[model samples]
Target: MLGSMAIRALSLSPLDSIAVVVHPDDPLDWLPALGNSAFSASPSAWPSIQVVTCTEASQGMSFSIRCGLKALIDDNPKLDAVVVVLADQPFITTGMIAELIGYLSERPELDYVATATDVGGEGEQNAILMPPAILSRSMFEVLLQLEGDAGARKLFGLPQFRGAALLAADRTTVFDVDTPADMVLATKQILGQTYIREHRF
Candidate 1:
């Protein structure tokens, strides 16, 4: 399962608890299978994960984020922060997840740390901050206040928020499956076809 690959990446991260948020229409039963598969090849000390069904997922991405954060908080009140990664990003790896967590860890003052895209220019205005992101618990309340399609990145612009941006090392690492063409490429990568990856730029 493609999502299993994504979950495997998360399972390998240095997290205490993991929560897989499923939408209303998704097969909630897949959670167990995915979790088992994810941890199969993971380290023996891999974190245990629970599946959460976001009933209001149809409302917006904000709902999914809220549901996921709440689940994680409930599972472990002492949880200091979380790294949010989209399941559609099949190419996401354990190192990428670790890097984001490490970046935020190195700077304890950070409210959030996210993948940054440099739109070929200078300065902060030319940069765009997106997930997968590490959000400190201090910023959780603000995320709960988000509505509509606004994601965690929306909170980056809030007044006095201290967020860091890790410039993405490769476009493939950020490649998200949003279209049929994307799925085809993801399939090619999954099958170990090297040409597509070598020429992805």
Candidate 2:
């Protein structure tokens, strides 16, 4: 039901740019379209759209995020804003992303704009955005030094990092593909049929 609802829900606007970071063997899927629609087409606008790859992504989630951010900044030093999106978040629609971009577009001074989802299992909603603040190359490096398993949460509570723009979205938005069970759910949702049922399980 969550997947169906996500497919129907109206979206906001396209982000200025989206960072689609994934592992080496990850599927391309709709990611290339996201890049083409948002970044590749408009040269004068946010022309620097990119799909970043984390060579060390095999290490863990932290490495993937750190690598992606570094790649973005390394390629475009003048980037004022960015949105970090995972490769498998099929529910993350263009409208939701646009909402975040529109908010940041209005208030450029805001450090970070994250999509907040109520993953009830966590007791509190989780924030999905990276750097979690507007940081310079040096600050990002320092944050990278702090990296462990948990990733961006380490820098979010820091002093210099201003704060995050918590834009509320559906809880199902954060449903990530972490395992085979997750894969089943994704397949069922995308195809509108249960994989288990199809396989006679």
Candidate with the greatest TM-score versus the true structure: 1
* RMSD in Å for model 2: 7.5
Candidate 1 structure quality by residue, lDDT tens digits, 91-184: 7777878898898889998899988777877645688888888999899888888899888888888887898888777767777888989899
Reference-based lDDT, residue 54, model 1: 93
Predicted structure 2: lDDT: 0.53
Q: On residues 60-178, what C-alpha lDDT tens digit does candidate 2 reach at each position?
A: 66787777677777777776655555555556665666666677667656555565554444523553443222333335665456454656655556777655545445545556666
* Candidate 2 Cα misplacement greater than 4 A, ranges: 1-53, 119-143, 165-167, 193-201
Model 1's C-alpha root-mean-square deviation from the true structure amounts to 3.8
TM-score of each: 0.85, 0.61
Question: Lowest-lDDT window of 10 residues in candidate 1?
Answer: 29-38
**lDDT scores of the candidates, listed in order:** 0.81, 0.53
